[model samples]
Target: MTLLAFLLGLALGIGFWLWQRQRLQRQLKQMLGVLQTDASSTAMSVVSRLRQEIAQANEHRSQLEERLQTWRRLLEVAPLGYLQVDEENRLLCCNDQARHLLQIDRWEPRQLRLLLELVRSYELDQLIEQTRHQQKPTIQEWVFHPPCLDGEAMGEVRSLTLRASSWPLPHGHVGVFLENRQPLIELAQSRNQWFSDLAHELRTPLTSIRLVAEALQGRLENPARRWVEQLLHETNRLINLIQNWLELSNLEKNPSKSLTYQSLELRSLIQSAWQTLEPLAQQKQMCLAYVGPDTLWIRADEARLTQVFLNLFDNSIKHSHRQGTIRVEVTAREAQVLDSEGTVDSPPFSNASDQPDSDASPSLIQIDMIDTGSGFADSDLPHVFKRLYRGDPSRQKSQGTSEPFTLVGSSGSGLGLSIIQQIIQAHGGTVQARNHPETGGAWLQIKLPDHKNLS
Candidate 1:
């Protein structure tokens, strides 16, 4: 009986231990399932948030691109040349007009670098230096006189007026603006020249009549004759001046009414001008010489050009010291080689099309009038060609010192240069006055388009 009880207790104890073990195993699997579900939920939440952030970032990028595109279009299509360069002189962007001006193609960020390297002119280099160092806007004028096709022709002459500025951008970029100046130059030339020439024509006749009347007053004692003669002379002068004014107005009103344009030898014109003024030159005892090429010719109006030389020679004679020498020199400028091995063909400014050796290119004819006389004061240089502008107010007063043979007669009504400027401009030319670089006297240079061989 005791052995049987022991066996049964052992069996029961073993069965209880096995059942507890299976229950523990089942509980452990349930715990594992709960942990896996939590992990999956957390991962899904993170992925969804990430996707939303990426979509927002893409939206922002699209908005930025649209804004950038709008700005780029405005920059590219603007009529004025637009450029953006960095402090390092690197071009970031340039408009079509800017490319045309620099004579460049396929504009790239690298092009700005090439331009900086290729642009060797002192004036342009100065502009860049000023912009980078000073951090301020600058204005400058650039005149391009390039040699014609492969240097076998004359290149067209073009002028550019550039206004460049730079300021700190939101993202650190620089901006620049460029404007064309051909029209402005033409307009200023027209307005200034017209007034100047009118003043000159008036002074000429007035001076002649004044001299005659003064002479008649002393020689003709008859009161009625003297009075009538004086009146007639003054009236004629007034009428001549008014008639010239009327003619000028008419020309402006009907611009299509073209004047005669012909090819005339420059040497012959100079000779004629010299002969016309010889008596006056001799009377003043001043030496007037023509130092120009024999074969050079200009396409211009004969009478008008003659008037330009006449005024210039007369002015030199009037202002020169007794026995002073007046020099008229002509120069044919040639294109310079850009690099050591690079050769540009022939000369510039001597032809019409600004291209050398071309059928259409006309050479430029320049006439320089240099006199060893008192030069204009520095302050008066800018206004020298203004109508009715008398040089040195003090000198105008000093006319009280009566001197005979003042043919031009004491600064000669202050219209000489104005008239010269007008006539030269009418012929599609330009004139400038400065102190002669070598002689330190008044130097007046007249440049006109030519059709003759500059070689």
Candidate 2:
């Protein structure tokens, strides 16, 4: 019986060991399944994140493309000519206006062609080169003669005056803007021609009228004689007006023409000009204070320069209060000196003469004429030098009292300053008008190159 019990116990122990092994296998399978599920979830999360990034990248690229297209459209329709060039001076892009201005044939938008080959403009190329090298904006103006095609007349050169401004861009590129100034210039020339023709037509009629007035002046008496004298005065004023118009037309037509330049004393010229208007000055008891060298010299056309001073003096005398002083000051200095009151580099009516001949001189003569009169009306300063620009009638009437005795030349023709400015410009000089800061009077300043300084 003891032997049987031992065998049964051993069998029970083996059964227990088999049951534990089955339980451990079940636990291992459960752990493996859990690990596999976690790995799958991690992989799906990574894939989702990568897809979102790709989509965002595509959207950003699309936005960039849209912006680029918008810019292209705007540039294509711009009125001003626009051109873009690459580092190699190859034409990268241009607007229709640019193509028309350059007279270039149509080409593919992306095509790379040398700019010189298409336009053949040295000035444009030089402007671009300058901008690239200096990395700064540059402006240039030149008259371009378009290349003649076959069957075109050799003399039929199409000339265009163009102004171009260029600036550097990223990647060694340059951008240029072009403007055609031919139309505006032609319009100005047309207006000038019309005026000149009108002036010519009026001259003969004016001369005949003046002769008639003179004849009538002698054959009248008493109040009628006074009327005849007034008529003569009005007629003579008209004649002078016509003469001045013709003279101005001639000057505008060719500023440098018929110039007879000579060295003469400026102070003496001023005194001489003053002498012609002495009777008018004396009528008002106006004091003339000439504060300049008695023998300052300038190279100029004596007659024209005398007219300049006469006009200025007359203007001052007409505007000065009775017993008020008109002071004339003259000084010589280097070209670099800046006139604190006014610089004659730019005048009110028109562009001044080009800088005096580079080889000529480096000295400038400055003249200041100040009148202790009602200063230029603040509103009238800009228009003072424009042809036929009259000041306020009230102001003119008030100033008219200064020279009550001289009736004929008392009032301004409104052409005095304009003519004076032109005469000074013809001498390679400039003139400016302003109110004296200290004196509260009319101030006129002139600058002329000193010929004695020439090397």
Instruction: For each candidate, give its TM-score against the true structure.
Output: 0.48, 0.70
lDDT of candidate 1 over 1-455, digit per residue (tens): 78888898888989998899999989989999999999999999999999999999999999999999998888788888877766665677788877766565545654556346533345555666666666666676776432224643334444454444444333334566766666887787688577657766777677677677666666776876769586766666565545444444444444334356777776788779888888877876777666545456556778877877777777776666667778887654433422232222222123233323323233455577887666555666778876556666444322321221122312354555665666666665678887765655578777665534422
Clashes of each: 21, 0
| Winning model by TM-score | 2
Question: Candidates' lDDT values, in order?
Answer: 0.62, 0.77
Per-residue error at 432 for model 2, in Å? 2.4
* Ten-residue region with minimum lDDT total, candidate 1: 401-410
RMSD of 2: 7.2
State the lDDT at 33 in candidate 2: 96
The residue-by-residue lDDT of candidate 2 on 351-400, one tens digit each, is 22322333334477778888877677776777877887777645542344
**Candidate 1 ranges with C-alpha deviation above 4 Å:** 1-137, 140-221, 243-258, 335-362, 393-415, 437-440, 452-455
